[model samples]
Target: MTTRRFFIKTTSLASAALFVKPGALHFKDAHIGLQLYTVRNAMGKDPAGTLAKVASIGYNSVEGATYTGTENFYGLDAKSFAALLKQNGLIMPSSHYRLGEDQENGKDLMGTILHDWDKAVDDAKTAGIKYMVCAWLSPAERGNADHYKLLAERLNKAGETCAKAGIQLCYHNHDFEFTQDNGQLPYDILLSHADKNLVKFELDLYWVNKAGHDPVALFNANPGRFPLWHVKDMDNTPQHAFTEVGNGVIDFKTIFKGADKAGLKYFFVEQDITPGDPFISITKSIDYIKKNLI
Candidate 1:
């Protein structure tokens, strides 16, 4: 993933705009954020500038993808980063982390097994992040439900420690979790086994749709469990193809209708690839969400 490409997908959208009644939309105190992974290059090249662009687009918060291989994020430690965010009229509330394992291959990747649970807690505390998430699980860990159960237990432990620091631990999902095993989805197992108070969910809209399911249905089934959401759009042609937020088939208005039931606190815009300029797509998506869903 090149730096700019990492900012998001290559999918394209027509330059059209919608005019929604402001008062008709349900606006929450929780402001929309961006997943920095979408603009990894921008962040790498100029963290401050990238963050400034994000805030300029009207997003008030962000979820970090990485910590720049240092305890600091983009050369700024927790305190400095917080100051930068405040200066830019933004907030850094959460981050996605490689949890429990260094690599998905089950090998001791990243030169370690991520053995420093205490250090991990301390680092996140220093960063002032309220949530530390195990971003994704590899196929190797998806061998069966038992593995998920074990992972859930481990996540609970991590979440418990985070709780002591006044932070929440969460899990982000891709399409794989919805894969059926013994007629049951692994997501169900993870959700059922994990401690609710300690751990929560960050639902990715594109992945949920790719899994041949309804995001709203999941929200309805387990109200108040999903506190975060990755708001991305799917191309009208197929599952994997990406598109700008409102240009695709995802009915975000309908999803937002369930926001209260879903216990949504933060929503972030993300794209793995783009058909055109990432800036255009990002700005368009933000406009769509602000105009329609809020």
Candidate 2:
């Protein structure tokens, strides 16, 4: 992983612009999606109210991040949660579910981490979700290149299961995947080994940039593999911490220009750590997207 200090000092604005191909960009009917993790604190306290606020802020879609041990969305059952989203005029096309090593303790492969995934898929179908995403990997889950290969296999199986229920499985990445293990990037390994028809990627732009890589280059390399993206930004500071979308140094305009090649279907704004009120942060981000990126 690139150190924050090095990134802040070395990342060049001119180089980022040079990476974008000159072309006219247009996103027809594309709406902004919010990753609920941005307001995890608010959602934990009041999911309904938080969603209402999100809707009012012009977010037409959402991607859930609170569907782990509960099996339910936040505190509501799948049906009720879907209803809540409808009430606010918001639709959730995707949700983040943790994927880990299947503890072979008499349980099916993914059954250990994603309890009752079949049922979760069924519920997601009912909620009108099209994608079930593996949100993150723990330090233990990603040990080396071999571990990523094994994870790709697991993802293929999971994607097959979801496909039976008309859902796609995707892996959302962080900066860690870009780090090399034995001179091979875990991201490249997964992309190479995973069944392309079954599994896809949800690229997090900020983390990719933080890792000292180019998003447009990845899109050019594996066209149509990345259908989802986390549209977060990196502050132009020593910490390179999470900040409101357009407030940071990331050139989203340059990246969005290649959305077609990236296979971008849905993108969610996610600021992992807000400088102040999260709602305020997200509002600023969406405003910027509306005026600039979208």
Candidate 3:
């Protein structure tokens, strides 16, 4: 980690490739990846079958949305799950976890960064996951600026744990992160206060735009800090709802132009709510990407 950090900070940017993880795919050559939450219903029904369908749709990579609840991928243990993905010709580079601070409500979320982080990291290693993302916060988790500051410290600690295991720790943001709390933007507070070497970000494009922020400007302000992205688009309507990739107003062509500057390693297409069959919607997104974005 130290060596990679030094290389990124140095003038000889040409040496970057030497630091890439073995078997890792760069942004442009990367196969289209998906956030499994986009197909949560199907995943809950049949994880193995759902992964096969996702691979059939041209998604060779995926970001996991569960693990905190069961400490396993769907019903399979870490090693078993990895075999399942391999059989389907898929890779899971990242997964999401909650804060796990809500255990008082009968939520025995033991596979969380806060609860049994080492076990989580061990399982992530076994599953061949390279990144772990703090996915989301419930309403009760949101708090004032002080709360965010505290959260930053906790994230840095979690990031250190991940680093020790050769996994990068990232935080996924929503529109609420940009909302002013205690006279300060919570997102800005995190950016300024978090340990940059320890914690990076996975920018969710739709949520960032929904919060009235420009993704490019944010990338410019914090170059190389963002390596992962959620590529969901917003519709050109009064409601500005979620839509398929090329069927919306995101201007991915423009946004993708900043991929190199943003240190992009991988991006996943996600739509929280689809009109009908999610497989059809994902097929539309991948088709658009293949035809236009690449």
Q: lDDT per model, in order?
A: 0.75, 0.83, 0.85
For each candidate in turn, the TM-score is: 0.85, 0.88, 0.89
TM-score of 1: 0.85
Tens digit of per-residue lDDT, candidate 1, span 1-294: 354222222110111122224332233443667888888878889988988888777677888776523556667777788788777877667887665453434644331115566666666787678888788765555678887888889889888888998988889999899988888888999889999888899999999988888888888888888888899998888445878899888878778777767888778899878777777788998888755674
lDDT of 2 by residue, 1-294 (tens): 975334322322111111222552334334578999989999999999999999888787899987766677888888999899989878899998877454335644442234577877888888889989998887868889998898998889889889999999999999999999889999999999999989999999999999999999999999989989999999999999999999989999889989889888888999988978999999899888765753
Error of 3 at 287 (Å): 1.0
For every model shown, the clashing-pair count is: 11, 0, 0
In model 1, which regions exceed 4 Å deviation? 1-30, 102-114
Model 1 residue 7 lDDT score: 21
For TM-score, candidate 2 versus 3, the one ahead is: 3
Better of 1 and 3 by lDDT: 3
> At residue 154, what lDDT does model 3 achieve?
90
lDDT of 3 by residue, 191-245 (tens): 9999988999999999999999999998899998898999998999999999999
Better structure of 2 and 3 per lDDT: 3
Give residue 71's error in model 2 in angstroms: 0.6
